[model samples]
Target: MIQTILLKQRPTGRPKISDFEFITEESDLTLKKDEMLLETVYVSVDPYLRGRMSDAKSYVDPFKINKPIYSGSIAKVIASKHNKFNEGDYVSGMLDWKTKQISNGNGLIKVDATKAPLSAYLGVLGMTGLTAYLGLTEIGQPKTGETLVVSGAAGAVGSIVGQIGKILGLNVIGIAGTDEKVNMITSEFGFDHGINYNSSTNMNAAIKKVATSGVDIYFDNVGGPISDAVLFNINKFARMIICGAISVYNNTELPQSVSVQPFLIKNSALMQGFIISNFSEKFPEAINQLATWLADGKLTYTETIVEGFENIPKAFIDLFDGKNKGKMIVRI
Candidate 1:
C-alpha cells in the first residue's frame, strides 16, 4: 500500500489543500516479465497542472475527480522482472503521486545519478529543461546581440530562457514579480536587465527602460497586461513564444483583454503557442543537449522544494500566486 495524493474536486479560487487528500492504495507490486516496481522520490508541480483542474479545452485532458495526479517524478527500481534493469536503478518520467509505483519498461528510462544529482532529472536535466530548450530555439529563434525579453523570468522555464539568451550572446531582460526574484535574475542569472512588474505601476515604461533597444524575442509565461506591455516594445519582425499563461490559469471567468494588438499589426510580428508534447519525438535530443550544458557547468537551475507529499497542492497554488522561485517540487 502506498500513500498518494488525490484530487478530490476541481478548485474554486486559489486551490486549497482541502481539494486534495492523502490516501493509501494497494498497488500491483509483484512484477511480471518485463515489469518493475518503483519507489518515488521527487514530484513536479508546474503551472500546467492548474489547467488540468478545469474542464475547459486546452492542450490536455482535465484531471479527473478522485484520481491520483501524475507529473514528472524521479524513482528507483526496487524489484524488476526485466533483464535490462535491476535493484537501485534510477528512472524518471510521468508517475502517479504514490510512494511506490508499478510499471513495465515503456515510459521509464534508466539514469546514472553519479553524473548529476538525481533531482536534476526533474528540473534542468529533464522535461522542464527540454521545454526551455525547444521552446526557445525552435520557436523564439533568438539571435546574438538582439534584445530578448522573458516573462516569469525567475521561474523554471523563464530562468532557462534568459540564461540561454545570454549564452547565445543576446542582451537578455527578465520580468518577474518580486524584488528578490528581480535581483536573482539580474545578479545571479546574468540577465542584462530586470523588471519588477509587481512594484511598477507603469509596465510599459519599465519594459521600455529595460529593453531600450527594443525586443527581438519574447518568451511569454504570463499573459494579460505583462504580455501586452512586451508586445508594445517589440522590434519589427520580432518573435513571441507563448509557452504559458499562468496569470489566468485559475480564473473561472473570462479574463480582461489586452489593448496591444496594434503593436503586433504594425510590426508584422510572429506569435505562436506551444506544448512540449508537440515535440515528443525529439525529446531525447533536447534532454541530451540540456544535460550536456548542465554537466559542463554552462547552465543553471533552481527548485522551490516544498517538503512532504501532503504539500503538493499548496506547491501548485504557489505557482499561480508567483510564490515560487524556479521549479516547484514536493518530496514524498
Candidate 2:
C-alpha cells in the first residue's frame, strides 16, 4: 500500500495536525513511456510552506484542498520507462508527500549519494543552501571587516549565512531564541558573537553591544520586534536582506512593527525582499561554491530528521514552535 498526505483544509493561523489527511491506496507500479516510479526517502519541511497553505495572492499558488501537498523531497527510482532515469537512481525535486509515486521527470534531477548524503540534497546542496548564498551575496554585497547581523541565527539558512559571512572576512553576530542556540552559533558555526533574544530585554542594546560599529549587513529571517531592533543599529549604506518572516507567518491580522522608512532614510540603507527562485540563473555557480566549501571543510550543516511518513504534518507544524535546530527533514 502507498500512503499519501493531503491538505484537509486551509489553516486559520498555526497549522494543526487535523488540517492534514492521510490516505492509503494500493501500489501502482506500472509506468508509461517517459515515466518513473519513485519511493520517497526524505522530505524537506520549511516555514515558507505556510505561505503556500494560504489562499492569499503570493509568489506561488495555494495548495488545493484535499490534494496531495508537495515539497522538496528525495526519492529513489524503483521502476523507470524513461530514457533519462533508471532503477536505483536517486533524484531530488518538488514532489508530493507520498510513499510511492509516478513521475514524467519534468523537474527531477539525479543526485549522487556518494558525493554527499541524500538528505543534504534537500538542504545545504539544495534550495536551502542556494537561498543563503544568493540572498547574501546578491543583496548583502558584504565587505571584509564590516559587521553582519543575522536574525534566526541558528536556523537552516541563517546558520549558513553567518558561516558565509565569516568566510568572507566579515564580523558575524547571530540572534537566536535560546541560550543553547546562542552558544551553538558561536561555538559550532564560527559566528563571532551570539545574542539570546529571549534573555535580552532590549534587543537594540544587545545588538549594539556586540555590533559596536553598527550593522553593515542585516540578514533578517524573523521579521518582528527583532527586525525593528536591527533598524536602529544599521550603518550608513547598510544592506538589509529580507528573507522569511517566520515571526508573523501565523498571524491572522496584519501585525504591526516599527516603521522602517525613517531608519532607511536616516542611514541611507538598502532593504530588499529576497525569493530564491528569482536568482535561478546563478544556481549552478552557487551549488559549485557550496560543494567546494563542504568538501574543503569550509561549510557544515545540521538536520533534525523525524522518522516515518505519517509524521510529515507534525514535523512541518513544529517549525513554528522552533523545535528543530537546523534543517528539518523527515526520513521514510
**Top TM-score hit:** 2
| Residues 183-268 of candidate 2: C-alpha lDDT, one tens digit per residue | 99999999999999999999999999999999999999999999999999999999999998999999989899999999999999
lDDT of 1 by residue, 225-299 (tens): 899888878999999999999888777787886655677799989899978889888888888888778777789
User: How well does candidate 2 match the true structure in TM-score terms?
Assistant: 0.98
Report lDDT (Cα) of residue 288, candidate 1: 83
TM-score for all models, in order of appearance: 0.95, 0.98
- Give the range of the ten consecutive residues with the poorest summed lDDT in model 1: 54-63
Give the CA lDDT, 0 to 100, for residue 162 in model 1: 88
